[model samples]
Target: MNRALFQKIIFAWFEKHGRVLPWRVKNHEDAQRMSGVRETLATYFTKAWRRDPYRVIVSELMLQQTQVDRVLPKFEHFIKRWPTVLDLSRAKLSEVMIEWQGLGYNRRARFLHEMAKRVVEKYNGVFPQTETELRTLPGIGEYTARAVLAFAYGQDIGVIDTNIKRIFARVELGVEANAIPISPKEFQSFIDFSVPKHHGDPWNQALMDFGALVCTAKSPKCDHCPAKTLCIAQRIAEEYRVKTYAEFLKTPHRNQQKKQSIPFEQTNRYFRGRIVDKLRESPIHMEELRMHMETNHGLSSRKKFGEIIESLVLDKLIYIRGSRASLD
Candidate 1:
């Protein structure tokens, strides 16, 4: 496939259909007036945009394994309260946890708190420019570090998230998401090769939107997909014992049932979250806390109950005295 042509197709679609997420505040409405050119992400956004690296990190941390709809209100309220790394650094862990009620992955909240503190204390509230330095912060991983670089700093790096992975597996590798042939390291390298210079921000964002809207997990809109012409999966349909797109979609990912999501209400995760949530109100007697978990949440084993409390203590989300447990 021609790299230049691939980029042209992807970008043309994005000029028409890219999302205006809260995290990426580029002026989509201004594209047409400006001859359909998307704005590049700078060190800080335009004054009208108000997107600093601080907003980028906060939104990124909150968005880990969490959806946009859930994170939007929380993200807004969060930055509104603590608009800068300096402000977040001063907040108590308990206060941050309280503000992080609805988002289930509680450790991410703690990590965000620690990350803010580190940024303020070590770097004087300035985000590091390099990926090596950024990864030193708590909870900032491979994908996140590059995301900050591309979306916030406009660096030319690939972010191989699940959406991008799915797109690549289909369009590049002619495989389904569940059956990629290479290891993560190799797949990342393949993704790295796809990023175009000077426009990696829009390019990566375009792939993400294309995957989410067109090249989706189960029901990809192959007929309407702009890259359907170049999608290796479609081009090689006959090789998979299929000749039509409809049959090709069924043949490749036939067993690709979405993993059944366990209800958050029925796990230790639920109790762990509830323990923090209950503690946010006030301290409670140890016995009363046990009773609440067992009675309300159907906690069966006393040993499991003790483990939950002990784990929360280990995680420093709570502290226990003689007969009471409270938020740390």
Candidate 2:
């Protein structure tokens, strides 16, 4: 359960049964030829293949309020479209929203676009190298900034996402297997002392993947867990496997809860569609577009339509045309 034993177990298990992901590998032709990978996934198990700072920033932004699997396709689509920070900075806000479709919680798209603008204007379209500088960007939180600094730029700092938080919480605190309450300060402490000095990036990845695959939320495979003995939850399991804090707590269920479904033919949908349709055609005056949305789309109020329009604007699916509106 000591640090040395914990590190030994986890590192050994990592060498044996680690998952292979595309982003983990270096794909450059020279790197590939030297690394003996099939031109696509050299260094597939290490941190020598993380994306650049800009891509890391984009991926982190997209990942907020969204799952990794869901973010992957959208990430690919976004990379194809923008390809670079300057490209994104110049892209129409509305077009970015359209590209961001299906990622729900549309506000993130707004932050991303704004962040890109700031990057272009201030950082000369290059991501900041230090965590402090990176965190100064729009919508870049501490965790995200640290992640970019560590994973992308290879800075030696601890980065804690949900997965790493869970692993450390259980391993250190004897909390429930899947229900650990993680705090930023405590997680930072773990990161400061847990990860090996030279291999901070891979060690972080190992923790993330270990939490995801071995120490999963619902049911953990403790028998094969690398840090099992170090894990407080496993110690609890050793004494009483199926009994923990989360198990005994009981709560009421508000069953049969349902949303008052908005009708498809409602003005909201119509106005939204019309806004998109018009934007597609060309930019229009904001006042004139508002009138169309209110009258033709049966909108209840200008304010309501305006809010929707604003949301669309933030999503970057539409553009403002000479103080008016346009589709991107």
Candidate 3:
């Protein structure tokens, strides 16, 4: 593959069509024009916008397994509420959980709170710059660590999230569906090779935008894709004019197969959310909580409900005082 040509095409497309996100910093001319402030792009960009590690960390954590549209308002609200690591570290975890109501995976909010506390106490409230230091924080993994380094610090490191991985699998490896797993080592090498040396941040962000908008997993816009000519999977799909790689690969029988039934209310996640939601309002006695769940949500087993409460207490998500339960 001609790497230079590939980079040129992708970057050109991104310049014209990249999404105008709130977290993204505006160009120098635009920033100055809007704010009536005479500052260099680098100064405004680093000190005021995208280079703020706290904003990047909050945005990244909220975005895990969540969509961009859903994250935008929440991210703005969160940052407005806690503008710095020191502010977040000083806030109560229960208040944090209350703010994190709509965004599920409540555990993430707890981890984020813990991460803030640690950063304040251990690192003097400044977010870490290196991948190793970042990974030491709560709930940060390999992908998230690299993302922080690249996006916030402008490090020339590769970031391969699910979307980028899918793009590489289809465009480079000729894989039809992103569901087909690629070796981690192979994927890392592709990211390393594809990421440009100088424009590492924009390069990674462009690939991410391209994957989300054009090269989506369910229904790819193959005809409109910039890399369609060079994409092996797209070339193969053209024979059938396939819109979705998964649909193209599905057998008729499998397509018609019935999905298994799982009751939402009965699941642990649902009950846990309910418990948190109720506690968000006010503290309730243990017996009163069980009765409310049984009456409203058809929760029949007291033993099962007790187990769930115990788990929540163990997770430090809630506290039990005498006979009452409330968010910690």
Which residue segments of model 1 deviate by more than 4 Å? 26-51, 238-247, 252-328
Task: Give all TM-scores, in the order shown.
Answer: 0.67, 0.65, 0.66
Q: For candidate 3, what is the total of clashing residue pairs?
A: 0
Superior candidate under TM-score, 1 versus 3: 1
Model 2, span 210-261: residue lDDT tens: 8778877766677666565577756654454344323312211101111222
In model 1, state the lDDT of residue 210: 89
Which window of 10 residues has the lowest lDDT sum in candidate 1? 42-51
Candidate 1 residues 1-328, lDDT tens each? Answer: 5678889998888767777665665322332233344444332123343236677787888887788899998986886688678889999999999999998899999999999999999999889989899999998997888888887777777888788999888887676777765556546656776889766677788898888888887778887877877878787665555554446667533333223223557555677788788889999998888888888878767887886686567556799988999986
Rank by TM-score (best first): 1, 3, 2
Q: Is candidate 2 or candidate 3 better by lDDT?
A: 3
Q: Per-model C-alpha lDDT, please?
A: 0.76, 0.67, 0.74
lDDT of 1 at 217: 79
Worst 10 residues of 2 by lDDT: 249-258
Residue pairs in collision within model 3: none
